[model samples]
Target chain A: MPVTENIYEPVKAKLTNIIDESPLIKTLVLVPEKEFSFKTGEFIELTLNGIGEAPFTPSSSPLVKDKLEITVMKAGYVTGKIHQLNIGDVVGIRGPFGKGYPLEKFYGKEVLIVGGGCGFAPIRSLLYKLIAEKEKFKKVIFCYGSKTPKDCIYKTLFKELRNIEKFQVLRSVDMADEPWDETIGVVTVLLDQIKIDINNSLAIVCGPPVMMKFGTIRLLEMGYRETDIYLSMEKNMSCGLGKCGHCMLGDYLVCKDGPVFTYNEIKGLPDIWR
Target chain B: MEITVESLKKITFFKEFDSVTIEKILKISELQEFDVEEKIFDEHQKLIDIFVLLEGKVILGINVPGKGKINLGTIHPGQLFSWSALFPPSISTAYAFADVPVKVLSIKASKIQELVGDNDTFGYKFMKIIGQTLSKRLSDTRFQLINMASV
Candidate 1:
């Protein structure tokens, strides 16, 4: 076994590479000072030394130990600064924290992952994990949406994956233009285009709060049991340890309890999904 | 193109209605087609008919003051579009463009209003579906707005 850094102490990391996903979005490929490991759906707090830290999920596959990746959209202060930083810059990393998607439960069943915008980041991580263990699952349906032709991310990756014989990737844009050949609509609309055996499948939805709500509603209406639906609830997780109450959903701290939760577990908690 | 009760029954939008009733509704409707990228209607245009997509895709967008067109949603097969045509002060709220060659069933607003006036039973069923479409779109649009909010 190799030595690992303390969980609480932030470790140094170097941004080894960068890919411009969109004008406002970038994927930072970093090499952590120590080996890094995170289950699908877990998140990390990236530090800019004195600037501050924000939580993001690694968009790369966990099976790959050589490097880690985080796809960030330039939305807030921390992310805007991240967008401006060069490829060789250094940052701090503090985790593999929080419970991740229940990979064990997904074995031998169909998995449908629906995500929109930057919310698709964590789902991308989970998708890669599932792709690596292809024989374990019966089927995988991934539907992703963006605002426009220019706003979609993972274009190259999706183009490649679509060529694979087994991966089912349905993409839509709120609006599309010339040279765009995919579906045009919110990602949820993709749900209507396919047939899912709701009784034997699970739906993992992570996206804008609004998208999650509607997507869940659509799934429920389609006969998917609430218990089988998993959601990634986004919150301001300042403390990776879950000690901070910033990410609370009633008694559950999103950082400690979940960045990933079954719809049944959180459905009873009022407005947590709101 | 021609629309009959048989064709109308095949559309999910009118699936709930039986042959006789759909036939009544079909008298006021006409089958229309749009080529890719054609403007089905523009924001603020007079809303003369309500359309139900029979095939292909339609993209909806609202024009911003200086930001150009921002897409709001898409219409798929068997889904209803241009609900504003059925309401008062009828005018489009967004621009709908055909993303692919599309076939749609257009029902004249005046004829639909007359039919609804004459049959209270079918009127309720018709209004209910429109209400559901409006509610669903309102909710999806709300999410779109929230997701587009700063940061």
Candidate 2:
């Protein structure tokens, strides 16, 4: 008889650092008892022990095996508890679940990334991977938006991204409470600022639902094929293994089938933006 | 450097116009340039020219009593602004400033009004474009309001 491993069991991870990203968002750096790994867009079920569990995509580089980072916005019960946690506190992590971005498809193509708010967490990880293999892609363009200058995350990362060859970073804020030098309006407006070779490009959108919807529409208008636009869909995923029907979308389960999907794969799915 | 019917056709506001209509527009339009931080228009100022951004950024804001100029949004290339010039009681609603070195196609509003009064078809198409621009700005403003209220 062959022994089977329990899938429900979570690997213990200890909080090592917490960086305040914004007034409402924090990035928790965790050191897992055992090495854990995941692809850039895949999610992990972060357990708060006695409190509860919530699904989050690791914000750290997947190439880094020992330490994982999860950026959390305090929006709900479990996430609120996770925000209150201190350094050295133990938490459980259940997965590196779901499919991530298809890097092979992105090779030899121009990659355009549109992200807003907390959605930058996953894209940041993806950026790390793309930067490591920069020679494979033709170019990378990133457009990001926030409600205000203060709401923007990873403030220092933008400077570093601008310094890299073949990488162009553009940012915008819906409203400028302070002096902001970048483009302003919604994230979609930044699409107009750059010249893209739509015939040889892939557009990736990850943001709040409104941003995602408008970003995808803008990309379509710019002549990108449906198959060339990728979206990160964050649904209410309960069981990351797909046993729970909580994250179902049309005929597919978001957790098992995707957190990342090409727009062509789920265009007519009901209430996808919601 | 030169303002022509062909150049106007490339602008979003004038893209749908016929060559004759664009030529009429060109007769009343001139290329204007502004340095960074230059104030282009002020809220409540009597308007004379309607503008289309040909290049660089423009910041639109309202002057608050104590908080100073509260930037509502930015105007990107190929966008129309100061449309208040087209209506009666032509008073600017928001102050416009160049956030970067900028170039714009400034059209005499009085000439455009005369053109609209003479040609109904031109009037309808031109007004339709302005209406669409207003609708998009309204939607963008509403989205910003919701974002301000959200977590």
Candidate 3:
């Protein structure tokens, strides 16, 4: 957030807090030294001094520039280093690269969001954007799935989101041991349990490949046209710019053309996504 | 070939998890149907859930760009497709396609996490199930790589 001299400006983003989404996933809330603007679905590259960088969405809405949040899971090398930073640690940040969700398209329609694991990060940003224009959409339903009750990231705030008048939330897991009150199955299974008007709705899904694959298949089966389904893809997106082929899925570069793509645009691509 | 809990109990990974726990996993996991020669998991796909071979076989493949797809190994019953789903936002390391009419016990990753959260003991037992599958396939992959090099 701090404006400095070089391309690799050392912006002192003070980690305001960390929200544990799950055992290995946490949302790091930071207060930038300066205001940084980004779209609802755009991403910023977070760099740890010695480690490296990874692309992540500012889970916080663009409307709120004073504070920004990037949800990270302790996964690979760079991300594992990100988890090591404490509140008040300084981490370098770059532009809010990539396009965001098409808020204009869902201006007056029902929107269904299906997110899984860390995939919830970008959707959280989109949700915050939609909440600003809550009246624009008739209804918004979030079907989020995590591995366990404890494995479920954002378990605490999800209840608050559920309280939103225009929102309906359902949390599910594939397997439960002792006892779980919520639905127990894949997040796609939540589709069968809910009533959706595919003709008048748009579906946004972000998650692992299998979930997205099956979720998209079920949505298509339920009459949700390919164009109506939007997906946020994940790969080892090293460079936020298209120059690096790390995030290329097909003809499209995830860093440039997407992070968010319509199902129709990517349907012809092998394996359903990039 | 059909595989039941009764048959699985004969394996070491299924030994600790009782019939009930196995039944629960079996009940929650769906059987994915795939056609022969159809890709089950493509290289571009995001890796989320892991697959357990229930019937028939699958080929773990890598796209060599210039040489087309190179078969890493074949997945058989008691083997897995992608165990990386245990970690979130996992990238699919390879392409998985059906070698024959295949049915796999497709377990949603969230369920695996929930089970682990509710009971680590239960989760560890299940991890063992996949871990054994992984080890077996890893050795198989080593063999395949050796064969490829030899040629």
Candidate 4:
């Protein structure tokens, strides 16, 4: 993981707009200093001046390169600085580091996407690609969960997204208060609401670690083969390269081999969903 | 409320029962309809009857401190609700309400035990289905509880 020019260089980008997704998250629209291209499931390092840098996936579509969208949640360190930034501010964008989701495998089959909280960031990249090439896939079902109506991200786009033919999007919140009449419960509840052809389908899951762990178990019980399910494993990516050693899960660097791995590939690995 | 053998067979809870058994079960069961927003059962209600959803949706909800009403899960078509009837001192653990116009087949708990006692085979088969559904619900509930507690 030497500083190779291709992987080490950071392209400059400017935040054109800021969207308040939740009280804690801001969706930043970036216009890169140069042309950029990356597939879904990959992430870029967002560097904020002297404050430092952290890894974040572009929640925007991979097909759209003119402006990239990164849904940044205020966790602790680097993200806190990002929340303070205003529009017209500039930041650094690095490698679409790591393997993007394997859309090639999903080309001819039905696809199930299960995401929770900010995990929707990477899944959104994959979702937009499927929408772009709708005819290539059989069916696409998206099951998303948020803590509440106020915490749901991408609310503005999902209404238009549901209009895609042969696609279904099911949303659930942990609790319902006012003016909310849709489903209420964990996102996995959507699995019961929708019917999937387990034999001919693939499930792509990303979310809080607990959701991933339990969601995997539920999918297994529902008869989905372990080989057909994919998970996004986002360990700490300090370098966005294999050199960091900080994001290691077994011998694999989450930044290098994944961000995406089939359940069969890492089933027995320790601390996988921890 | 119309209770027929065919209708009973359509219910997931009674799917394993034979037509004769289903016919007999229907004698002890009654068809129930719930209008939208109607509360079919309340939490901690003392009852020994379980419901099988035939049409529409029922939301099983529990009140969470600081969080208001959190849905335990959904009881979809062919799914069972008020499963406490199968256990002693049965009491509803959550409130069930019609999310939409709904129909269900209700079977009394005492009648279930009598039927099981009459046919050992039916008892085993009946309990097996209940166990599977209950365990799956337990697992999902445990997961949801963890998620809620974690937050």
**Candidate 1, A1-274: lDDT as tens digits:** 1124566678788999999988888999999877878788888888897788999888999887668899998888988899888978999887878889989898888889888888878988888888788799888888998877788888887976687656789988765543466776667778877767778899999887778888888889879999999999867688877787888887889988898998988988878755
> Positional deviation of B45 in candidate 2, in angstroms?
4.0
Q: What's the interface RMS deviation of candidate 2?
A: 1.6
Q: Model 4, B1-151: lDDT tens per residue?
A: 5667886676667778899888777888888899998999888788778888889988888887897776656777888889897787888899999999999888998998899899989889888988988888877778777877876
TM-score of 2: 0.89
TM-score of each model, in listed order:
0.86, 0.89, 0.63, 0.94
**Reference-based lDDT, residue A149, model 1:** 71
- Tens-digit lDDT string for candidate 2 (B1-151): 7777787788777778899989888888889999999999999999999999999999998887997878887898889999999998999999999999999999999999999999999999989989987876776776677776774
User: Worst 10-residue stretch by lDDT in candidate 4 chain A?
Assistant: A1-10
In model 3, what are the clashing residue pairs, if there are any? Answer: A21-A153, A147-B110, A147-B113, A147-B114, A148-B114, A174-B111, A175-B111, A209-B46
Candidate 3, which segments miss by more than 4 Å at Cα? A1-10, A272-274, B1-151
Task: State which docking tier applies to candidate 4.
Answer: medium
Question: How would you encode candidate 3's per-residue C-alpha lDDT over B21-78 as one tens digit per residue?
Answer: 8777666677688998898888857876778776776766577778676554455565
In candidate 4, what are the lDDT values of residues A48-159, reduced to their tens digit? 8788989988888888868899999999878998998899999988887888887889988999999999998988888888889999999999999887788888897688
lDDT of 3 by residue, A201-257 (tens): 999999876667767877887799899999987665667777778887779888888
Error of 4 at A20 (Å): 1.4
Position B145, candidate 4: lDDT: 76
The CAPRI class of candidate 1 is: acceptable
lDDT of 2 by residue, A129-236 (tens): 999999999999999999889989999999999999999999999878788998778887788778889999999999998888878887897899999999999877
